[model samples]
Target: MKIIILGAGQVGGTLAENLVDEKNDITIVDTNLDPLRHLQDKFDLRVIQGYGSYPRVLRAAGAENADMLVAVTNSDETNMIACQIAYTIFKTPNRIARIRSHDYDCESEQLFSPEAVPVNHLISPETLVTDSIYQLIEYPGALQVVHFAEGKVSLVAVKVYYNGPLVGNALSSLREHIPHIETRVVAIFRQDQPIDPKGETIIEAGDEVFFMVASQHIHMVISEMQMLEKPYKRIMIVGGGHIGARLAYRLEKDYSVKLIERDRERASELAAQLKYTIVFYGDASDQELLSQEHIEQIDVFIAITNDDEANIMSAMLAKRMGAKKVVALIQRRAYLDLVQGSVIDIAISPQQATISALLRYVRNADIVTVSSLRRGDAEAIEAIAHGDQRNSGVVSRDIGAINLPPGTIIGAIVRNNEVIIANRHHRIEPGDHVIMILTDKKCIVDVEKLFQPINLSL
Candidate 1:
């Protein structure tokens, strides 16, 4: 697909890298020449330097022939105008705009029909990242959860703890203890790529893994991972920015929320705006105040301050104080590399995660759970085992039985809360949800072809 992206900053750059890594034909446009040049030098993509909101810029980036047009510049008005123009003039098939403000236009897509601007998708990185963090806090040991097919079955991530119930276990050994729920541990991010392992392959402590299951069984899956879910009742958010305010609004629907803001005026404003939530006007940087607010009794703690360092520190402190779950909204991916083995519960970047969600939408028709684990085209995917009529020979076999696609892996399967690590003999059933962490771009489409008969559910 030929995609035209407007913005050359962190959001655009990350999206460009992920798209190019997927080997998708990409053209990135920006007003500044430096970031575009940096993108051009970094990846094999066409980068255009011009005013992103202008007609010439859109045309320069080949928007007319583009499969998708994405306006993600930092400026919300600029993005809105650019998308309106693109849809009006270029008639781009899919146009997605990034809206930075917390106040969404809260109307149904059908409501704004006929003469107004039509945006195919509106991505709020802050909302996705913050809400994901909120889910972790509410569900405690969720490991990972990606809602797909419009929130039917969510793909959840879990780490096999060295000391927990799954330690020293093999791919085929899980049924000995747990039963009833058919859970699949789709991919194991051990030594980076998804592995097709033998039954005896032990789950080490450091591997980050993903699983696919019915949305209803989410709590059960967390329990199986030996991490209990603490119902998030009393919550505390350390920032009152867009992420913090929006999260508080969502949380106040069910959970009691208390938000701490350093700025007195903003806190007063937030207190007025968020009538349900308790908005505190104070410094969250001070650990003493956190204790006064009953940090120990709090079910969940969210650190979503604008400062990345502050958010990380606040979340760490919350965890140390015995909070069941702590979430940090740190925007930079660089911080993730150094925090290697630390347990901060969940860490998310708004722009990065929003793009992650967008990429999943981009590959929606063919692939499921398209997430960049850390870097590069190597992705964590839950490919529904679609049986193919085109290929007659590759049937009832594991990754080892057939000449598998390059860089493709069959990670795990849920055959009635049973989590089976992928092995050579394991076969993908019609309803089996397969998680693949594949690097080969062609292998992605090819594997989907093999499992085409199975439901490629939304």
Candidate 2:
């Protein structure tokens, strides 16, 4: 599809780069000449330097031929105007805009619809980031909280601490505390690998936990484990940007939040905007300021400064200084290597996480489901096991019956809602979400073909 993007910031630039690799026709518009030139030099795509809301700018960038127009400028009003302009002038199929205010209601959206200008979707990254932070607050013990199936199954990650509440507990014994969320402690993340947990497996402190359970039952597990999601009495936030400001306000209702900024004017402005929070002007990285603010005893340290290295270093230093939970917002997605837990407790990559979520909405053709590539080697492909597929007479009558290549592990079969993890006795059923962990890049097509042999040539 022909896609036009407004804004040359990290989010837009990352999207253009990622989608360009997928062979999409991408064109970007930004007032900044530097980023426009950078995008042009790095990728084989059109770049226009001007206000995207301007008619000549939109037309010059080929918005008339665009399948989708995405507006994500720093100013919400500019993004909305750009999307509205593209929708009206180009008759674009989709107009996606990034808005700062989460309270934009139908009355506001109607002003930019197809009748006026077709704004198809609106997403506020500020709101999403706030929700993510709220999830962490609700489940302090979990390293990550991912809800799938519209809250049917929730995934939580926990790290074991020495002498912590759950030390030495049997895997089965903990279920008594698990509410009927149909909770399953499926795997243990040990040595950076996911290990299937057995009933006899003892819960050790320092072991990273991955539990899939019903959303309603999360608190039950917490109570049973005897670990409380401690209500943060105090939070220290570095960087007073949109993400930080929103997070501070959202958190201030429950915790005393202090947002520190290096910019005196911006800090003063944000102080007026936010209530129940203290905005201070200071050099956050300066150890003297951190000492003065008493960052060592803060329950949570949030590093959301615009600078990646600053955020990482501040978070690392805070953890070193004995802060309980250190959450850092990393702007650039390319620096994933530096955001590991060794740098911060929670490293939220906004661009990468946003793009990952968007892919689920844009693609899923012929493919039923797809997960991230592991070890950067191959993708795990999941397809259906039909009756005709079973009868094809390559016919060993089961997965073991097939002549398959090495490094192919059939992980699970979803017959109805139940996910059977390598329970080989169960025969493959038609309309099943059959899963295989592939070790090679090209085997994805081969694996898909085996599941849907009638389209073998595909």
Best by TM-score: 1
Which 10-residue span in candidate 2 carries the lowest summed lDDT? 371-380
| Alpha-carbon shift of residue 39 in model 1 (angstroms) | 1.1
The runs of at least 3 residues in candidate 1 whose Cα sits more than 4 Å from the true structure, single-residue gaps closed, are 108-114, 190-197, 227-229, 364-369, 374-388, 391-458
State each model's CA lDDT, in order: 0.71, 0.68
Whole-model lDDT, model 2: 0.68
In candidate 2, what are the lDDT values of residues 1-458, reduced to their tens digit?
68888999977887787567656799999999999899999999999999989989999988888888888788878888888777766777778877766456325656656676467776666666666777877776666665543344455566676755668978877655443435556456566555557678888866776555556666666544446666668889999987888888888888888999899999999899998999999877788788888888888888887788888888888887778889887775555545655657777766654554443333322345443331122334455656464344222246666655555555555566765544344466666655554444344444544654454445
TM-score, candidate number 2: 0.67
The per-prediction CA RMSD against the true structure, in angstroms, equals 4.7, 6.6
How many clashes in each structure? 20, 2
Q: What is the lDDT of residue 317 in candidate 1?
A: 84
Model 1 lDDT per residue over 299-386, tens place: 7788888898988888888778766667777777788655534768667667657776677667633455566554333556665554
Estimate TM-scores for all models: 0.83, 0.67
